[model samples]
Target: MAQHAVPSAAAPDARPATPVRVPVREILPWAIFAFVLAGVLLYFVGAEQGATSVFGGTWIHEFTHDGRHLLGFPCH
Candidate 1:
């Protein structure tokens, strides 16, 4: 019987291992930034410009006023 020794060599540099990407850890700051941006856009867009509301019809008017009240904004 003949015995053969195994060769131990590093992998070829031609094909490198894929790099691992990690997500951002500080997401709260980004979320706050987005919230502020949306508010600024909404302010410039003007809420009263639209006749149609998400609530629809008479319920829409009531819902809008109630939402404003809940948010501490005086609509009426």
Candidate 2:
């Protein structure tokens, strides 16, 4: 009896096989921008959430709880 030949299962490479380069200089500006934006957004969220320091109490927190008086809008 004759034996049949087996086929290989490896695939051919179509890429350069080198890793892509990242530019730190270009990335630095966007990183800083994102950090600053996140900080500002966090501040607003904290303020809305009634965050206070030792120096003083949260005015917005108090105002939100004290009840809002409005001429055209309903108090919530």
Candidate 3:
């Protein structure tokens, strides 16, 4: 009597997975929007006081007071 080899039941599939692609053109507008949004937020938190005030009062500064101190901005 001769012994024969047996195949394993846990063999991997032969199909390959497709890779995902991100195009720069599609992301540029969103990147620019985010940049502008960040700039606006930074302005409100850092420079929304004194002569550069946008709302003509301390409302923005008061609202972002804690954040200013946290980010090390001169609030006083």
Better of 1 and 3 by TM-score: 3
Q: Encode model 2's per-residue lDDT on 52-75: one tens digit a residue.
A: 332255665455443333222232
What are the RMSD figures for all models against the true structure? 11.0, 11.5, 6.1
- What lDDT would each prediction earn against the true structure? 0.55, 0.53, 0.87
Residue-wise C-alpha lDDT for candidate 3, range 1-76, written one tens digit per residue:
6643643455464355699899999999999999999999999999999988878777888999999999999989
Q: Which segments of model 3 are wrong by more than 4 Å?
A: 1-12
What's model 3's lDDT at 48? 91
**Model 1 global lDDT (CA atoms, 0 to 1):** 0.55
How many clashes in each candidate? 0, 0, 0
Clash pairs of candidate 2?
Answer: none
